[model samples]
Target chain A: MQTKETIVCRCEDITLEEIKSLIDQGYRTIDEIKRVIRAGMGPCQGRTCRMLIAQELAKYYGIPVGEVLMPTFRPTVRPVKLGTFAGGE
Target chain B: MPKVKETEILIVGGGPAGLSAASAAANLGASVLVLERDEKPGGQLIKQTHKFFGSKKQYAGDRGYQIGDLLIEQCGNNPKVEVWTNTTALGIYEDGVVTAEGRAKHLKINPKKIIVATGASEKMITFPNNDLPGIYGAGAVQTLMNVHGIVPGRRVLMIGAGNIGLIVSYQLMQAGVEIAAIIEAAPTIGGYLVHASKIRRAGVPILTSHTITEAYGNESVEGAIICKLDEGWQPVSGSEQDLKVDVICLAVGLSPLTELCFQADCQMKYVSELSGHVPVRNEHLETTRPGLYVAGDVSGVEEASSAMVEGRLAGISAACSLGYGEDIAPKLQAEALAELSELRAGPAGQKTLRGIMNLMDKGGAVC
Candidate 1:
């Protein structure tokens, strides 16, 4: 496993220090932390950062990792062209 | 006599838009009920493991799942809003009634106004072995890896370069899976340049003007045969490339779930730009069918951020139609229009705008 020092949340390029600050700010939930710091809204989505955030939130809240909720996946899971959708017509 | 489960408004879909709609209406002092098919709210945002772009007010730079949580908290903490999870809205009746099924029990309820945030369904492309066991939608892969903690495959061949395709390829890498390649029939990468740049930097080959013609596995996808396309999309001669991969992820596109709107007999039009046939909705997000409203992908295929704005508009629009704070609807409508316009600004938004224009032209209505 990569060390905890690796920058996971790329959108904000959030480091461990900033995430710790969010936890100190009473943002225990991943969602709350994200809203406060813009941690996960980059183009890569949360692919690289979600698990790490979950871990940090758990450590901060003193909760088990399983208690944390994951994000919902929607369709078009890849970027699709609108033109292709209408081509059938 | 039967407990009188009633609210001034009902919002279906439980996605970002649905949650926002409930929050928007409740904040306006209106009683609201939100129905979600999933065990929890947040819709696709829950599975989105990506960061978002936009302004701070929109939670730009937040992961999709985090946004889902914030919205859920905002909606859940409000006394005026009641959210039902694992509740499937079976159908939308003409008289502003919603039929839902939960725990194998069916129930019917009526609200003064309705907002259809039912979202859209994943589309599929027909190929010789598309129905094979290993073939799945890109969204499904996300659910498995990001949500369920199970990798979709050891090696994957992605078809499509739109945002979904590109993003998933990167995600598969994050999950420690190898991406053989991403194939798109278009001459250029379809999704955002930043997204493409990420995977490209990671050494994943994005083959444009190429497509997977067939999957060659008896019952599971073992490998795929890809080919380059001419201007007419016909496979050019001798352009075949074969890939060895366990999973084939289709990130083709989504089709709006406008059937409920159509069933209500709202003014419907086949707008190719809108992801499929959609209901003709006005500035207030109200469908032509007076009390009926459509939000999120069902209105048109847009992101969760836009869905939130549209959801707020739809909820406010519905609340106004129900005779609750009717005067405030116009102001809310204007704000939503402005927000949506801003969200649609940028290079990637050009195609979306084009799609919306096509939809508007087909409906012969002003956007």
Candidate 2:
């Protein structure tokens, strides 16, 4: 139960305690948590932590995990250099 | 703008599904281009060393990697199929222009029909210290040991009793590593009894209704704490057990990697039965967006056998839409559908069948 130190978002080093506290403080959605705590903004782009966060939110609200709306996935799904988009080889 | 490369059918993610699609479409005289993000053409199939289960048409008795090789060979031999490795499909535009990043350059491909066989990603569970260096997804462990010949750890604690968990545990033992125990949150083992018995005979206990609570390590995984779960799935008090383990392997489940479908503005429905959010598609596997299709895990998480069948179905369907294989397309399509229904007729395929029904029942834009 030492959740205060249990890391949830490995990229941003956010902890489970931080996520739960955010849920308790009315930050219920994964997108909201990402905006506030930078959970899904890392290079991995939430591949690892988004679902984990969604599960937490679903648990707190006593709702099914699928009911939670996943955040929008933007273009260039993988991280690419600006030059790549500029047609540079 | 650089001149956009054009093809009749473009398949993304050259895994079992993508390669199969490429072959199916190319055999029908459609110019097929496959974009694979990895260095090699085979997707997860390359790392799976276990023999597959299914009808003989799917190469059931052959090892998974061998089947992958067969699919790759078929595509390679077909002059109509062009596979580009180390090329990542960045996005699917509304205008039907697919942009991708090749080994050293950005390339835009204009294909008349697109097949999104991007596959799925492993699901993770929530537990304290789960992010330690030694902890990894089951697929990652397979990749390290089977593909690269590097053992992950000396002692491993596998979480989940699904087929992947059991198979990976057996594979780990094959690589001369010791498994502490295999734990499952479910009350009963979820994988085939055959796989379960293989590891059980090896003396690795399968602890059902048990879950890992925390991993103990500073720089990496050194140990873990597991406990029995109650009917409500909450950890039972006073049932915690500590075990010395160097690696924690998670084989919880997989969610379809549908980011490309979402980017393409395809209508998506979250079917838990499918394992996660999936794009709504029809019997032919074409998505809400015309000229766009999804095969394999991107449609729903299922066995590789089913993924291959789905790939063939989507490939022929996409090719048919492009006016290729006019005379033989219907018969091939029907055969693929029958084979799919047969694959789903077993007890294991019921969940996938239900998931597909849920998606198709709520009809989307006609392709």
Query: Each candidate's chain A: what TM-score?
Result: 0.68, 0.85
Categorize the docking of model 1: incorrect
Whose DockQ is greatest here? 2
State model 2's lDDT: 0.89
Which CAPRI level is candidate 2?
Answer: medium
TM-score of each: 0.78, 0.96
Q: Residue by residue across B77-195, what tens digits does model 2's lDDT show?
A: 99999999999998888788999999668899999999999999898777778788899999899999998999998999999998899999999999999999999999999888999
| Candidate 2, residue B142: how far the Cα is off, in Å | 0.3
lDDT of 2 at B73: 95
- Runs with alpha carbons beyond 4 Å of true place in candidate 2: A1-4, B363-367
